[model samples]
Target: MPRGFWKGLLKVLAFFAVIGGIAIAVLRVWFVDVVTVRHNGMAPTMILGDRVLVWRDARLERDDIALCRHPQDDPARWVIGRVAVMPGGEIAAERGQLRLGRDRVTHDVRGQVRFTDGETRHTFTMSWGTEEFDDYEEHLFFDRADRPFALRAMTRINGLYLLGDNRAHLGEDSRTFGPVQASGCRGEVFMRLTAAEGGLPDEIPHGALDILD
Candidate 1:
């Protein structure tokens, strides 16, 4: 190649590199959150090893998936789950039923989720049901006819109430700890990632390729 052609190519590459670096900096500092699913607390909804993209400062409402600080004040730790109640709203459970402000979060049984855990090879049978809250509705996984743990009853005090979709892991979220401070939340998990082909077993619900909720 001629010297002029080489020089032009170098300049173009430098310009692109500068632009790319700036974009990445903005994303990491203010917008992007790449979260790895570390536990099966959100089983059937999200499984272990899933990579998720959480957008910072996104407005979170009931039924939205949230990424927040762990209740134990571990700066290195993060907790992700569905928002059961927004700030200042009451969330509770009666017997085995979920409720918010004395209203039941009711839904019809959609189907049964049957999937094998990729890590433990354990098979789970969870009742997939649509839970309604005000004008919004979401599908969630819960214990079947044979309950492993009863849903504990309590009312929300303050902050954001978050809970895992997998009721079998009922103690994994806000139910075990108190509500998470809304201001401390990192963001909303809007996207879930998957491999194009067979590097690992696929475990996400309905084989969803993207968008967790």
Candidate 2:
């Protein structure tokens, strides 16, 4: 190989390497975070093993899907839930319905969801709880005896109410602990990198996706 040709090839490779490194740094510092859904907490909207692209700096909003630290568990472990109430708001659950101030968050039953995996069939009624049915659970209530005896008013100080879409599964969420601090939040889930498939039912009652007013 000619000496000049070798030098030019080396320069080109270095240029491309620098560009790749800058792109990665930008993504890590200010762009996005890729996370995987480890559980069925935000089911239908985001299922187990679904990979998601989260905007690390987007402003949180009511009904927005987000990745945040569990209120009472390991801070390093991230939990996915919807922002039911934002900072400076009060949240409460009454009769299986969420109430924000004077307005009661309402949902419309869209349809039924059913799917089979192997020899097992799973079915449940579907509805939009906050804005989309995908991010919130259909109204499922615990028995009066099993319900929390003292339902405290969750006041968002510098945090927000992070609740799971599958309320019936109630394990890690504001309902189990309290409101989630904003500082513990990682980012807002803007896109699903994984295809919506598998044992999950695709049919929704109303429009496939609709935001509740």
Candidate 3:
């Protein structure tokens, strides 16, 4: 082959490689992207309108905060919560502590949670308790029935159940519906960028640090 022809071919290959790389990067960011809090779910730990970077590809474990789509609702929208259970395991709330099957979990108290559901969003207020569930339970309390609701026998193989730190009063998680499936999970959250003001009261609002790998 001619020397000039070889050089030109190499340049063309390099140009295409660069273009392909850029395209891949953009697609990854779009699918495995970040979400900012428009409302309050993490509360004192995370304020309203905080920016959180999520990892759609990260391996999710118990207690890892994540961004996911609604398992029972429309998958178009995304929400945030922490992993409390694993496949074959169960999560329950007792004395404010989260129970994983029969195992007990302890967690740090961050803030309160206020949840509203349905068409108009029914409001419920819960405080930040001394203890919180650090794991997943199969039996969850149901409002309509006195008995606990048994979760799917098999945990969503692809995803984790996300929940807000403010369990009792927050609408930031699965307690309102059910656990979040893995397919619905977009990614793990790395940072929490909070708004300057307005959402929170007269409090020094600080966002969460990056948790993405």
Give a tens-digit lDDT track for model 1, residues 1-213: 999999999999999999999996888788987778887787667777777788998888888899998877677789989998777677656667877886877767766656555556677676766667676666656555566434455554678888888777755698788788888888898877552221122333444357677
lDDT per model vs. reference: 0.73, 0.62, 0.55
**Per-model TM-score versus the true fold:** 0.75, 0.66, 0.58
Better of 2 and 3 by TM-score: 2
Instruction: Single out the weakest 10-residue window by summed lDDT for candidate 3.
Output: 138-147
How well does model 3 score by local distance difference test? Answer: 0.55
User: Each candidate: how many clashes?
Assistant: 0, 3, 28
TM-score leader:
1
Stretches off by above 4 angstroms in model 2 are 1-30, 115-152, 155-158, 204-213
Assess the local accuracy of residue 210 in candidate 1 as a C-alpha lDDT between 0 and 100. Answer: 74
Better of 1 and 3 by TM-score: 1
RMSD value for candidate 2: 8.4
**Model 3 deviation from the true structure expressed as Cα RMSD, one decimal place:** 10.9
Sort every candidate by TM-score, greatest first: 1, 2, 3
On a 0 to 100 scale, what is the lDDT of residue 201 in model 2?
48
Please give the lDDT score at residue 205 for candidate 1: 42
